[model samples]
Every structure is written in structure tokens, then in C-alpha cells.
Target: MTARRPTAIDIVEVGPRDGLQNDSRHLSTEAKVEMIAKLAGAGLRRIEAASFVNPKRVPQMADAEAVLARVVDLPGVSVSGLVLNGRGFERALAAGLREISFVAVATDTMAARNQGTTARGLVETWAGIAKRAEAEGLFRSVTIAVAFGCPFEGEVPLARVIEIARALAESGADEISLADTIGVATPLAVEERFAALSEAVPGLPMRAHFHNTRNTGYANADAALRSGVTVLDASLGGLGGCPFAPGATGNIATEDLVSMLERDRVATGVSLELLRDATLWLEGEMGRRLPAHGAHVSPWPRVLAA
Candidate 1:
């Protein structure tokens, strides 16, 4: 263990949006809201509940307005939605989303594939979004996708990532997240990238989004904690992948992340017993066994104490 680490952390539940976006079986708007209510009942205060994008592009996220309309009133919970462009941001604003998360990819090819724009172009879009969203009193956040490694571009330079983080901070972003879009991040790399991002963007709150594509999501989460990151993103039941990024799958499960963090004595303000119960319900909704470990096994004593 390090000589010092954060005594508490914030875990953003991304299951309702990121977890279901790529699943083969589409959940109805009612089902999506139900899942969000369950997550809220489980003590998740920050939930990425919906994505505002074109239905033709992401059919699973078709009824973004409908989903948000139902779950935004979860008591003591702040619901957010993902937005990629100006139109998506407008939709999120109009749909009553208090927090809007925008994604910026690292490589040009990935940017083109995931967002239909280059990396530089996305930053330009963000500048405009920051101005309007701030005026509207919305909490603005940006996620740097494929920050570790890109499927098409292979290795994403740390220098480029730092530059992007600096730009986002300068453009009025309230917080920034470095996403391991393809799950190639190791523990060492996780620490290094976060350290650099912290150095680059100093006081801007930094978040991490990791995939278990190579089974290192949990380890990377530990590394991020060690590196002094207070916010981490995970999905329920470990279900997630980018539709445009080939072979990418599995976000760190909320049950697993909360269990590990609480075991380390870091207060996440989430109840693992409640998270486990929600994951089980998610598995039933997905109509198959999920890839999460904590939900399938017996809860440890510490998990129950959470």
C-alpha cells in the first residue's frame, strides 16, 4: 500500500447508458428507466443514464428524451447523459439533463469512426458547447476516448493526451475523464497517464473510464486510486463496448469496483449488497449470465459492511 491515498472516491454508474448501448437485445425506455431507478436505490448518486444521439446511428439509445424524463427526478441522484456533437448537446439540454458528458477521441481514425470528426474538430465543438452549457448552468464534462491506445492508430502518445487535457481545461470543462476505450491500459500506464493529466490540468477534477477488454480494469482502477484520482466510471454487470470500436467489451463492474474500493477502506458511499442485487437484476434483464465477478459469487464480509 502507498504511504497515502484518498480516503474516499466517487464512482459514476455508467450501466444504463454505456452498458446497454452495444447490447444485442435492446431494452425498452421503460426498462431503461427501471434499471436507473434500481441503481439509484443502490446508492449511486451520479448515474450516466442516457445518450443523446441519432437513432439511426445508435438504435439502442433511441428514446433518450423519454428515458431522461422519467429518471431525472431520482431523489438525491444527479442523472447525466452522453452527447457527441452540437445537436446532441442541444438535445441533452432540451431533454433536461443537468450534466452533459462529451467524448473526444485521441486518434484521427477513431475520431472519424466514433464521432465523424477529427480530434481537433471535436475540440472546436467542445469550445462552443462549453460556452452555451455553462450559460445554461449545466455541469460540463468531457471524456478523452482511446486515451491509452487506439484500435486503428495503435499507440496514442502521452504528449498528445496531455495536450488534449490542457485544451479541455482551458475551454471551461468542469471535469475531464481519460477513457481506456479499448481496455489496453495496464496498472503502470494507468498511474502514468493520470499523473500526467493531473500535472497538465492541475485542479480540474479528473475521472477514469476503463474497460476489461484485457482483464486489467480492476488493476487500473487500483492504480488510479493510488495516483490520487477521486472519480472512476464503471457499468453494472460489466456490460459495455464501443459499437464502432471492434472487439472492445466489458466495463469494470459497479459491484466489483465498489467491493474492491470499500475493501481498501476507501469510502465510495455505495452499498455493495445493494449493488450486487442490482447486478443480478441486470443479468436477468440482459437474459444471460454477465461477466461481472462480484455479483456471481458470495458477498464478502467487508462488502456487506459497505
Candidate 2:
């Protein structure tokens, strides 16, 4: 029997935050706002538009408040912020963002290197953030970074991921996201872990965040869909990486992912042509040819808007 696939999906654009955090260049606040506006114009409804981390740690996101102030009014679009600690979460709350994504790593070494905490400590942090967001009636999501594998700690056990997810689910996360931080996951692994998470934490929604660092990100996305995950994350122009993860590459490009999904009759509600156009604009602004192939190629004929 054929497996059921989601006819439609939500692709949360992480371009403004995760996409730029690792870049050598820091885009002006105006440019960042323009990027978010252009992404929303292309039908990206859910966008991770800013990160509220220390400027010294991730300077590219230093203008988090300024960027949010400008883009929060985009009609019919949801603007969110990423936070790694209580202070960042508090800043997001003060900024009045309705949604926030909190990240927790899978292992101690990655946690220390990424944020100078233990994985368990991050989980504790998430519980509190979730509680505060709930009290504030804000949408809260927790991403399990390096769920597939960690550069510092070769392989992260599946049990550990399930444990972390269980804690988040119990702690009031509106959504649970799994990140392939360095992109070491295969399709099989993606399917297995998502299935296991579903079984362990029944009924909670799942989101997938894949990096194209190993060229397996798209395949992992397919597996996540087949495993009943409808929400996925991508960076515009395929331009993002975790600064904590060495040798990691950009994310699965939004245009490329949209093109692939549209071909399979999966509705992402994104305009492929416009996405391609956006990719070109981004490349020109950043002054580099992104790893994504969508801008270099033509969208499938049938998927174009009239």
C-alpha cells in the first residue's frame, strides 16, 4: 500500500535569522526587513524574522528589535524570534512578538559549544520559556538541534532525542521542531525518528528543520512528510548554517524545496517564480552565488502562476 502524503505543508522561512547568523557580512536592518517583506510577498506566511541573542555572539542578528519593529506589521504574516536563553526570550516578549522558537541541543558538548550549557539545562530553560509564553498567550516552539548527529559528539542517541521531545511536549510547546544541525541524517533516519517521536508524544504537531550540509536535507524532508509531518523550515536562497557546527553548509533552499514539493503535488503555497526571483535578489545583495539551484534553473511549467 502507498503511504499517505500531506497535500499541503507550512514551510517556515528562517532566512532573516538563521540564514544570516553565520554570514561573514552583516546586512543593515533595512536590508533584513526588506528580505522578510519580500519573503512574505512570496507567500511565506510563517517567518523566523529575528534572533534575540547577544550581539557579541551573533552580530548579524544584533538588530533583532529594529528588524521586528519594521516587519511586524506585514499583513497576514506571522513574525517570530529565536531565543537561546531567558534574556533573549524576555527581549522577544518585550518586543511583542507573538511567536518565539527556543532551541535545545541533543548532547552536552554541542550544548556547551553552542551556548555554554548542558542539553538537560537547555531543556529546563525551554520548560520555563514555554510556561512564560503560555502565560503571555504567545506561540512557543522548541527545536531539538543536532537531532540527527552532532559534530562534537559523533552520534546522538535516538532515545535522548525522544526524552528531550517528551520534556518539551509536557512543558507546553505549541510545536516541536527537529533540526539536522549539520545535516547528517538520511531519509531512513528522518522517517524513523519522526515516527518514534509521534509514537512517544502522540498528537503533538511535528516540524522538520533540515540543513543541506550533506545534500541529504531534501530527502530527509520527504521522509518527514511521509512520517506525517506537515510543517518544515527552510532558509531563503539556501543560505544558513549554525556557527556552532563546523563545516556545515546552508539550509535546503526555499525555492528549490518549493519546486521539488510543487512537482510532487505537495502544496507549499509559495510562488516558485517569485521565490526564484527572491533568491536572485538575495544573491545580489549578499554578493555571492548561493548553493541553491532554484534561481539557476527554471520552475516546472505547470507550477507557474498565470
Candidate 3:
């Protein structure tokens, strides 16, 4: 008998934020807003608009507020931004953002390297931020970096991910996102970590963010879908990578993932034609070729042939 499939999957388009953060070419604020509107038009309901971090640290996200303000009026869409600390959270709130994300690294070395703090210290800081966001009824979510493996600190233990998950769950985080920050995740590792997290924090809503750096991102996503993870983060044109991860490329393309789901008889509430057009438009705006593997792979050639 064939394996059963899910009826639908939630695709959180992170191109505007995660995908564009490390790009060498700077996109104008207008261009960013246009890209977002196109994605929304392509039927993406949740788009991570920008990061409310130190512009000095990520110059690519300097126009985050400007981008967010421009797209706030898009109906049926929930816009979000990432905030690293209390100050960033305050800035996000002041920018009229209703949803926001915070991040914590599960390993001490990665946490320090990424944020110059210990894992415990990062958790404590996120706890405060989560509480504030919850009290104020703001959309509160936290992403755990290096949940599968860390580039700086190779072979992160599963226990560390669970510890961070449990802490975020207890800290009033509305959602916990597991990021394969460096794209070193395997299907076995994804299943193992997610199962561990589920057992530790029962019923805590979870999301998976993967990078196609090693060509395992789609497989990792497939594993998560089978593991009952509903929220999946993908980018248009697969246009993202972790700057800290040496030799890493962009994320799994949204069109590619959606096309696969559609071919597999799973629903993603996204239109592949629209997604394709948006990616092509994004490639044109970026003024160079983009890294969209699924478009090249033709996941549904047999279906298209018939």
C-alpha cells in the first residue's frame, strides 16, 4: 500500500528576511516591498518581512522597517520580523508589527559566536522577550539555531535542542522553530531531533527551516512532513544561506517545495505557476541568476507529460 499524505502544508516564505539577509547586492526598499507583494500575490500567507537587528551587523536588513510599513496593508497576510533582544523587540513593536520572532542558539560556542552570549543567557533574554510579546498579545515565536548540527560546534547533541525547546515552550513562546541553520541536517537527524522535541514539549507548535546547502533540505522537509510538522519555511528562488556557514547556499525554494507537494498529491494552498513567475521576477530584480533547484529538477515531469 502507498503511504498516506497530508492534506495541506503551511509554507512560510522567508525570502524577504532569511533569504536576503546575506546577499552581496543591496535591494532597494521599493524592490523589497515589490518582491513581498508578488509573493503575497502568489498565495503566501505568512512572509517574514525583515529582521529588527542592528543595521550595522546586517546591512541587508537596514530597510526592514521601511519594507514592513510598505506591505502592512496587504490583506489576509501576516507580516513578521526577527528581533534578537529586548531593544530589537521594542523597535519591532514601535514599528507597528503584530508578529515577531526571537532566536536562540542551542550550543554555547554557536550562541557566543552568533550573539556573543551563552546558551543560558540567550534563553533568559528570550524568556523576557517572549513574556513581553505574550503580555502585549504580539505574535511570539522563537527559532533555535543549529538544532540539527552546528558549523562552529560540529555534531550538536539532541539533548541541547530539547533543553532549548522546553525552555522556549515554558517561556510563553507561541511557537518554536527548529532551524537547520548550517544545512547539516539528515533525514534521520531531523526525525530524531523533532521526535525528541515533540516528546519533551508535547503539543508545542513547531516549524522547520532548512537550507539546501548539501542538497538534503527537501529530504529533511519531507521527513518533517511525515513527522507531523505542519509549518515549513521556504524561500522564493531558494535565495538564502547562513553567512556564518562556509560554502552554504540559499534555502529550499518555495516553488520547488510546493511543486513537490502538489505532485505527491499533498496540498500546500499555493499555486506553482504563480510561484514560478514570482521567482523569475525576483531573479530579474536581483540582476543575476538565482539558485532555484526545483525549477530545474522538474519534480513532476511525468505528470506534466501526461
Candidate 4:
């Protein structure tokens, strides 16, 4: 058998938004700005800086607009924000953000819990949002969440995800993403589902957002890459969880994913040293420890002793 060649990996840092939103500790705008700047200095080109959502639900993202303004001008870094509704999308556009991502779940139960609407209504709403963003020339992409599996409603059918992807693509979304929102996916499930998605939507740029709750995040990420997924969403120091999905851990750690990619010779355009520093600074700002394997486990001494 022939060896499979390594593929280019695009690590999209979602720590600023996803990681911080679920955190109990509220971070100041300066802290958020510093964290993003450090990540940028670490060679991360794509970072989801913040989300424009109701402050009542996610107080951590209350200063999203300010954060975006502070970090968008940095060189070689593209900042993106997550918008849940038309109002949120408008806020992102008004903030001069060129990249935005919207999400809808695959099951009605999960959708209602997450978005306060049925899955069908959520899809319709996102389609309209995609059209509006396309007309305004501000929307960059849209993502359908819980595409792989749902917590409220376990075992989301592959057909549902494919249907949502097709609808999003048809609605003029430039890119689509599948999220393991509850972290219930195994490697086999990841491969099968992603393969089905590839066959269903050929050439449509897709991203995978996996959580490390079940310890299958890295394995699932490797599966996604092999299945032709290029964009991978991760959080620095594993900083996020689904507020709606109880017991859900953080997203795949940015440092851990980057380490895997670099060791495998995959091009991620990220610096481990800079990422480690970002994680440490984030932990300091949060006044607690975050879950990052590479940061928690050091290799400096081993390499030096050798």
C-alpha cells in the first residue's frame, strides 16, 4: 500500500470567542486584545476574535466590537466573528468586519436550546442572513453547528447535516463548517460522516470544529484532514465549552493541534513558542489554568538533556 501524503492544515483559532464565552471569569478588553496580539505574533493567520451576541447570555463577549476594532488592523491576521442572528450579523458588518460565521444546529431540540428556534427556522434565518451578507459584501462564511452529533438529541443523522450543508451552500455561503458541538464523535464516525459530506458537497470549503471532551478530538481532527478538510477550529489552551451542553469540555487545544500538525510535517503556519506564550498569558489573565497539553507538558528539558 502507498503512504498517504500529509496535507496543509489551516488552524483557525477560536479561543477569543468560543473559549472565553464559556468562561466564568469576565476578561477586560485590554486582556482580550493582548491575547489576540500574542496569537498573531505567534504566526496564527486566522483567528475568530469575538462573537456579536446578547450580552445577557454571554457577558464575556460584551466587548466584542471593541476587541475586533483593536485586532483587525494587525498585519497578516484575518479576524472573524460569530453571529447568531440578523442583528448580530449587522453588528459585525457595522464594525467593519469582513469575515463572519453564523451557525444553526441539526436537530430541533438542540437548535431550540442553542438558538431559541427550530432547526428549520434557524436554517431559513441563516439563509436570509447569508443573502443579506452577500449583498452587503461583508459576510465571509457560515457554519452549521452540531452537524456531526447533537447533545439534546443524540446521534444526528448524516442526512440532516448534508441537507443543511447543501442549503447553506445554495444560500450563497462561501464556506460551510461541521461542529462536534457535544464531542460525541469517534474516529470512525468522523471519517464516515466527513466522507459523506465530501461526496455530497464537492469542492465546497469546509471546516471541522471538534471538542476534546471524549479525548477523540485529535484523532477526529486527523480523520478530518485525511478526509480532505483543510480548516480546523481550535482554541488556545483549550478554552471553550458549549454553554448549552453541560459537561462539554474545551475545544481542541490550539497548542496541541499545532504540535500534532507540525510533528506530522503538516503546514499550519503557526509557531509553537508563540502559541505557548499566548496560552500562558491567557491563563494569567483568566486567573486560572486552561487545558493545553503542550503548555501543561513541556518538552524543553527533554530536548535539552538529549
Candidate 5:
């Protein structure tokens, strides 16, 4: 008997935030607003629109509040922002964002490099953030970066990843995301790790975030879906990388992921043609070709002429 695939999946569009944060060129607040509006028009319901980070650190996201102010009224879209600390979380709340994603690195070395804190320290901070989010009636998601492998520390043990995830869960995180910050995971490894995570936190909503540095991102995404992950994080035009994780590439393309899921008979509630158009616009704005496969190929003709 053939395995049954999920009838539907949620693709969280992280292009406006994750995709643009690492780019050298800074997009204006207006440009950010336009990009997000186009993405929502393409039927993307969940979008990570901005990050409340220090401007000196990530200038691309310096206008998080402005971007959110412009696109918060877009119909049928749930906008979320990334927050790293209490200050960032407060910024997101002030911007009227309903959902927030908090990131914590799996290894102490990465945590120090990314956020200037140790893993334990970040977890402690996250506990407080979680309490505040709950008090304010905000949704919170905890993303464990470098869950598969860390650039500074080479390979991260499964035990360590699970331990961190468990800690975050105990801290009142409503959702969990495992991120392959350096994109070094194999299909089997993704399956095994997600399976382990599922066993550790049964029934918890889990997400998978991957980079395509080594070209295993799509495979890992497939493994993640098969392992019962309900949400997959992707970027438009495959436009992002980690500023800290050297050699890391953009995420799995949103258009490509949606195409694959649609072809596999899974529902993603996204329009491929609209996604393609958005990618083309982004390519033109960036003045270069993007890495997304859907951006390069023409859509197949629905009806062939005899």
C-alpha cells in the first residue's frame, strides 16, 4: 500500500525577513512593504515580514516597525516578526504583531557568535520572553538554530538538540522549529532527528527551516514532511543566507517547495503563477538571477494543442 501524504501543509514565507536580512543591499521600508504585499497577493497566508533587531547589526531589518505598519492590514495574511530578546520582543509587540519567533542556538559557540550569549543564557531569556508573550496574548514560536550542525562546533549531537528543545518547551513555547543553519543534513538524518523530536514533544506543532548550501535542503524538507512536520519555512527566490554561518546559502525556494507539494497532491494554499511573478519581480529588483528553480523554468502548459 502506498503511504498517505498529508492533505495540507503550511509554508511560512520567510523571504521578507530571513531572505533579505543577510543581503548586502538594504531595501527601503517602502520596498519591503511592496515585497510583502506582493507575497500576500500570491496567496501566502503566513509570512515572517520583519525582525526586531538592532539596526547596526542587521540594517536590512532596521525598519521593522514601518514595514509592519504598512502590511499589517493586508487581508488574509498572518504577519510574524523575529525577536531575539526582551527588547526586540517589546518592539514587535509595539508594532502590533500577533505572532513572534524567538531564536536560540543549539551550541554555546553559535549562541555566543550569533547573540553574544551562551545557550543556557538564551534559554533563560526565552523563559521570560515566553511568560511575557503569554501575558500579552501573543503567539510564540521557538526556533533552535544550528540544530542539525553548527559551523563553529562542527557537528551537534542529537542529545544536545533534544535537550534544548525540551528546555524551550518547558518555557511555554507554543511551537518549535528545528533549523539547519548551515544546511549540512542528509535526508535520513532529518528524518531521524525530527522523529526524535516528535517523540520528545508529542503533539507539539513543529516546523523545519533549512538552507541549500550543500543542495540537500529539498531532500531534508521532504524528510521533514514525511516525519509529520506541519510547517516548512522557505524564502522567495531562494534569497537568504546566514551572516554568521559562513558558506551558508539561501533557503529552499518557496515557489519550488509549493510546486513540489502541489505535484505530490498536498495542499499548500499558494498560487504557483503568483509566486513565480513575485520571484521575477524580486530578481529584477536585486538585479540578478535568483537560485530558485521555479524562477528559471516556464510553467508547463496545462493543455497541449493537437
Candidate 6:
């Protein structure tokens, strides 16, 4: 018997924030705003517009407030920001962002390198942020990076991943995301982990964030879908990588994912042609070819007269 398929899926576009954060090129606030608007126009409902982190650390996100200020008016678009601590959360709140993503690494070493704290310490910090968000009626999603394997510490234990996920759930995270920070996860691993997480968390929605580093990103996405994950994170033009993880690559490309999903009859509410066009525009702005496959290929082929 064939497994039941979901009628639709939620795709959270992370281009403006996660996509550009590690880039050497700095996009002006205007460029960022324009990119976000184009994404919204292409029917992406949830977009991660900015990251309220220290500019000294991730200079690409230095214009978070300015970008948010300009893109907050897009109709039907839910703009969100990434906040690692109470300070970042406060700044997002001040910027009128109603949704926020909080991240915690799976291993202590990764946590220390990314957030200047241990995994447990970052959980504690997120607890306070979650509490405040709950009180303020804001949406909170906690992403556990390196859920499959850590760059510093290879093959993070499943028990450890579950433990950290439980802590974040207890802290009142509305959604939980499992991140393949260095793109080391296989389909079997994604299936097992997400199935275990579903059993462990029971009711909370799950999201998958995969990188195409070793070319397994789309496979992992398929696994997540089969495991009942409702939300997925992708970047426009496949434009993201972890600065702390050596050799890590970009997230699965939004247009590429959309093309695959739509072909499979999964509704993403995103227009593939428009998304591809956006990637082309982004390529022009960056003056380089992006890593997204859909950006380089057409969804439909033209027919020649026989």
C-alpha cells in the first residue's frame, strides 16, 4: 500500500537572513528589502527576513532592522527574524517581528563556536527567550543544528539530539527544526531521527533544514516528508552555509525544492517560474552563478516542430 501524502507543505524561505549571513559581499538594506519583496511576490508566505545578531560577528546581517523596517508591509507575508539570545529577541520584538527562530547546536563544541556557550547553556538562554515570547504571544521555532552530525564532533548521538529537542520543546517552542548543518545526513538517518522526534515530541510540528554539501539535501527532504514533517527551510539560489562548519554548503535551493515538490503533487504555494526568476535576479546582483539546480534549468522544455 502506498503511504498517504500531505496535500501541502510549509516552506520557510531563509535567503535574506541565513542565505546572506556568511557571504563576503554585503547587500545594502535596499537590496535586501528588494530581494524579500520579490520572494513575497512569488507567494512565499513565511520568510526569514533578518537576524538580530551582533554585526561584528555576521556583517551581512548588520542591516537587520533596516531590512525588516522596509519589508514589514508585504501583504500576506509573515516576516521573521533569527534571535539567538534574549538580547536578539528583544531587538526583533522592537523591530515588530512577530515570529523568531532560535538556534542551539547539538554538540557543546559547535555551540561554543557558534554562540559562545555550551549546548546546555544555549538551551537555558532560549528558555528565557521562549518564556518571554509566550507571554508576548509571539511565534517561536527552535532549530537544533548538527542534528545528524557535527563538524567538530562527528556523528552526534541520537540520544543527545533528542535530549536537546526535548529541552527546547519544554521551553515552549512552537516548532522544532532538525538541521543538517554540514549536510552529512542520509535519508535513512533523517527518517529514523524525524520518526523518533515525532514520537518523542508527539504534537509539536517539526521542520527540516538540510544542506546540499554532499548532495544529499533533497534525499533528506524526501525522508522528512515521509516522516510527516510539515515545514521545510530552504534558501533562494541555495545561498547559505555555516561559517563555523568547515566545507559546509548552502541550504537546499528554494526553487529546486519547489520544482521537485510540485512535480510530486505537494503544494508549496510557491511559483517555480517566479522563484527561478528571483534566483536569476540574485545571480545578477551577486555577479556569480548560484548553486541552485533549478536556477540553471527550466521547469518545462520547449518543443520543436516535428
Q: List the residue pairs that clash in candidate 3.
A: 240-250
The true-structure Cα RMSD of candidate 2 reads: 2.1
RMSD of each: 2.3, 2.1, 2.0, 1.8, 1.4, 1.5
The residue-level lDDT of candidate 3 at 275 comes to 82
The candidate with the higher TM-score, 3 or 5, is 5
What is the RMSD of candidate 4? 1.8
Query: What ranges in model 2 sit over 4 Å off?
Result: 244-247, 302-306
Residues 214-239, model 2: lDDT tens digits: 88989888889999898999999999
TM-score of each: 0.96, 0.96, 0.95, 0.94, 0.97, 0.96
Off by over 4 Å in 4: 1-6, 300-302
Lowest lDDT sum, 10 consecutive residues, model 3, at 297-306
lDDT, model 4: 0.84
Q: For residues 35-134, could you state the per-residue lDDT of candidate 3 as single tens digits?
A: 9998899899888999887899899998888888899768988888888888989988888888887888889998787788989898999878887888
Deviating ranges (above 4 Å) for candidate 5: 1-3, 245-248
Pairs with steric clashes in candidate 4: 19-239
Residue 66 lDDT, candidate 1, scale 0-100: 90
Over the stretch 161-182, how does candidate 4's per-residue lDDT look in tens digits?
8887777777777677889987
Q: What is the TM-score (0 to 1) of candidate 2?
A: 0.96
Instruction: Give the C-alpha miss distance for residue 58 in model 5, angstroms.
Output: 0.9
lDDT of 5 by residue, 1-306 (tens): 433657899999999999999887677788889899888998898999998889998888888888899988788888999989999998988888888999988999988887899998889999999999999988888999999998899999999999999999998977899999888888898888998999999889999999998999998888888888889999998999887656567999999999988998889999999999999999888887888999778676455668
lDDT of each: 0.88, 0.89, 0.85, 0.84, 0.89, 0.89
Sliding window of 10 residues with minimal summed lDDT for model 6 = 296-305
